[model samples]
Target: MPSLVAPLMSAGCLAGAPQPSLPVEGGLLLRPWRLADAAAVVRVFQDPDIQRWHLKRADTEAEAREWITRWQQGWQDEVAAHWTVVDADSDAVLGRVSLQSIILMGGQAEISYWTAPWARGAGVCSRAVTAVAGWALSEAGFHRLELGHSVVNPASCRVAVKAGFTQEGIRHNALLHTDGWHDMHLHACVR
Candidate 1:
């Protein structure tokens, strides 16, 4: 039953490496989420666009802290890796980027992201995604990275393209949002 190639990436590849702070364009940095950012997280989840796409909301700072806690623990579990994108000078929260559905066995993971209202139109999401994907593919030893967004979200498609991911195809009814199911455009980059 075990007829297959060896793991494309070693087990514990992520757990063995500490999460790192990454730099992005426009003086932004991607760092591990902290509990102190609970308030900002709540603020972002309030945005209707985010709620629609991300399909979740943080109505309270306590809930936001729990989310942050999960992101922290995910590093050890090697299931997900989330980062808060912030301004390098003032450390203002600008957005988020994450590697989800991590499969060390395949040396691959999916990328996710969002931009704060204030940071929209400033390319924060694209830049952060690029930085994170670059690190995941090169330093983190992942062979491939994927980015998927609702086909309805053209802006997200733009972010993926700008981040150097190529559009591979679309999946019908692949994403479940709060409203209903949505088709998703799939994008990918290989190291």
Candidate 2:
């Protein structure tokens, strides 16, 4: 019988990857999510702005804990890297940022983020995203990082721009929110 192992090995299908580490950006620290963050996650998701954009709601502590667990699993699976955006000085949870849909073989990933209500209007998301993008491009050796947001969310668009992501174009009817399908503005940054 012909061996399949030779083909797989030649294709680089068995390459090992490294785990991601927490990144610090001045006042903000991008650290792994913990069960202790459940309360903060619940509170942040309860905000109307977060609910309107993200669609997924975590109203209870249990659901928030589950969300944290999923992030942990994503790390183990090498599919995503999620960070709880926290204030370095106070260690207070300010929001979250993630490098999702990570394809190490392709050297690309997508970024997503949300800021706590109290943390909004202060460029928290923008700074956090910029730091993560720098890490992804330089340390992680990723060539491209993408971000998209509902066109209706101008705030997110501004964040993307401030973080150095170039606006690419619109994806028509890309996201399905509670209201309905909405167009999304695609953005990207290249190393």
Candidate 3:
């Protein structure tokens, strides 16, 4: 039997158009990843803090290329969208921001990000999140966007709040990192 609810967004609403490069406050812009970014990708993943926050690491240029392939495929499949946050003037990557687990029919997605070691403590991640959230809510037509972070990471909590996502609650043992399972603080914003 079919459910009574209507989907908030159309299936092709996102994939129908090319992904956009968003220029936010600060000197950052969110642009699609390229294979040429392989070296930078590997370098960023080598950071201990990045590895701790995001389990996987790209050790080689080939591995970074594969990651880029997946990100591009995700956009075509309309399942997710990944953007490399870069210096708008120089086009050098400062970090990355992504809309993961996108459900276009439901008008919802989850946001994730990591900053390059050099960009840390300079508010790059928060600025990227703010840019992506604004686009997802206003232009892309998503009804809600969620940001989840391990409760142990206060920095992510600060980023989420600074990006305007309200803390909803915690999910018990929601994420499994290399250390062990962790409770996640769930934050969200609705259009």
Best by lDDT: 3
Using all chains and alpha carbons, the TM-scores for the candidates as numbered come to 0.96, 0.89, 0.97
> Order the candidates by TM-score, highest first — what do you get?
3, 1, 2
Summing lDDT over every window of 10 consecutive residues in candidate 3, give the lowest-scoring window.
Answer: 3-12
> Which residue pairs in model 2 clash with each other?
none
| Global local distance difference test of model 3 | 0.92
lDDT, candidate 1, residue 88? 98
lDDT, candidate 3, residue 130? Answer: 93
Clashes of 3: 0
Those runs of model 1 whose alpha carbons end farther than 4 Å from true positions after fitting are: 1-3
Residue-level error in angstroms, candidate 3, position 77? 0.5
Q: Write the per-residue lDDT of candidate 2 for residues 59-159, one digit (tens) a residue.
A: 89999999999987887776788888899888899988898997766677899999999999988899999988998887767789999999999999999
Question: What is candidate 3's TM-score against the reference?
Answer: 0.97
Clashes (N, CA, C under 3 Å) per candidate: 0, 0, 0
Where's the lowest-lDDT run of ten residues in candidate 2?
6-15
Q: Order the numbered candidates by lDDT, best leading.
A: 3, 1, 2
lDDT of each: 0.92, 0.85, 0.92
Alpha-carbon deviation at 47 in model 2, angstroms: 0.5
